[model samples]
Target: MRDNQITKEFFDWIRQGNSGCIFAKLFVLRGGDTPWEASVIRAETFDAPTVEAIGETLKLASKRSEAIQLILPNIKTPEQIARMISCLCKNPNWYCTEIIPKPSEYTSSFLAGLRWKLPDAVNVNWVLGFADIETMPPTRRAPYTSLAIRLGQPGTAPSVAKDKPNEVRSRKKENGLVPVHLADMPTPFLKDDAIKKTWVLTEQTAGKMLNPTPEFRTNAHAKVTFALPMDLRDSLIGCFTPVAMDSKSEIGAEEY
Candidate 1:
């Protein structure tokens, strides 16, 4: 049939490594038949003159074949974009094989938040869903304490809880980072004073901290956060005394 032949040819075109697209913030680039690099610049906005200035960056990146982003807008029209994309397969300096049309919301938001601070290049492997992204690099100062408290007897446990209305994944351990802001150095709360000890108080003064003394808060870099591991959860058998507290989050309550 005519349709069958046309479909075969279209699939063949893609199968030959002639073209492809990814749904991330970047498009994959190939030199010869091997994918060696990637870029944020898309062919749909083919502003050739604007990219002329950064042509060398593209060439160098392609040669190094590093996965990084470029600042180049594309042109209009699918036909025009096709021509621009096809150009990637040709010239050695301009060997840009595939052009990804759009970026996912997660990838776009992640890149947008960091591009201002790290405009040059961001490691593709650093995004979410990838391997562990170390909040504090191993090269940094060693943690003074890593309290891993558990409640119930531990054995085999599922990574996520599914019995409830929603499934919740287990949390990884987080290091408490110390804060060293200049304004916090003078407010010490660990002095000999009965006047300040009459009432039960949580450290919400001079900014706010849940745990860690005010003196220790300024000296050590730490944030007040509390999270319980799902695997350690156990139902109480005795009478339960309920305790509740009011709190506000900087962002707000998350829906999903």
Candidate 2:
């Protein structure tokens, strides 16, 4: 099938409400070389019924031997993956999501090949997955996975946070002062001066940091400083920087 045709089918599937993860295959043929590339796209905002229709629609598309893949819902187990492969092989554009390196091999290949170049706040790697396969072509031998951080308005797709994996879940649940470099830090909305000479920030909590972004400081019209001895200020500033602010994030907002 053509690229435009696959896109049309994708949007149509969306209209029908089949949301979950989708596998996309793209094939380009020139001269004797036929390059096949496959990717995974999790439905950021489709419901179950809609996702079902998308699965069926994709099955039909694969039959045409086009460069597109559609991963239907309810195919979570290895057996299910086998069934999916059987169904997809009928399409001339067959490519495997699984490759040797390990659980993340295919996903790593996709990111390296595509180099998607996303924004700073959104992490896309967390959303990719791969299937188990027996053999793969040399060019296609590497495993492939695809994930994205949505940049559109929040309401468009329920928010990616709700679908984060357990690793992320653990990170969110982590409270207490986790030692972090001063340079690498999350937005610090919470901070306090335990002593005239010491400043403390909590990674486990939300809002209120001692030294917030320069913009926040200017906006709040508050004179802010490290509150450390003058001689130590420059050295502390270069350390992994944490933030301090006087506002609060909404309660339980981290869940989503």
Candidate 3:
């Protein structure tokens, strides 16, 4: 009964925008049937809100002697924090407010990366106030993260199309397969010569070319190619194909 009350309070605190870590520790020390299942808590939600939820969940699980290591800084962004809160909100059907802060150097690309995850149209409220900014805890995280190196030898190259990935049938899901080269919106104001030079050097270094033609660099960057199913490759490239530009100020930024 006491554990149930704690669980309810912990969730309440999160909805009220309280940081989850403080409560997380308390729950961890409780050591009983964790309010949450480890399988439900992703390795990714280790920061403020989610971390708190995780801590509570872990505490319960520890009682049963079935807990794992707590991964830190798992909270990546405010949206992720908000999403978790939204997910666990008592009003389970509440729609997320779409919030888009203008892109700036100070804003983490992490939030911008969440654009696709948001509901189609979101309401953006100014979440920061002058006093709030002064009282906010300092984040010790590095802006640039070093990607972990994958262990073990690379897999042997596949031999046939039967081994290929399934074909994408919808434009909506096709964005996931967008080719990496065309993933970023191409810069137009930049010189073509400079773009070509960089592309040539990169291709040569990566051994992407077998019997390269003079126009290969331009074509390679402009279109997509791969060893996968041709239909999948086409679907991927089509996602990034530039629509006609209507005005000088209308460059569509590719959502990474």
Per-prediction TM-score, please?
0.18, 0.20, 0.19
Report, for every candidate in turn, its global Cα lDDT versus the true structure: 0.21, 0.23, 0.25
Better of 1 and 2 by lDDT: 2
- For each of the candidates, give the backbone clash count: 12, 29, 7
Per-residue lDDT of 78-112 in model 3, one digit per residue for the tens?
Answer: 33343333332322111122222333312211120
Candidate with top lDDT is: 3
Ranking according to TM-score, highest score first = 2, 3, 1
Off by over 4 Å in 3: 1-183, 206-256
> Between prediction 1 and prediction 3, which has the larger TM-score?
3
Of the two candidates 1 and 3, the one with more favorable lDDT, higher being better, is: 3
Instruction: Tell me the deviation in Å of residue 231 in model 1.
Output: 55
Candidate 3: worst-modelled 10 consecutive residues by lDDT: 123-132
* lDDT score at residue 34, model 2, on the 0-100 scale: 18
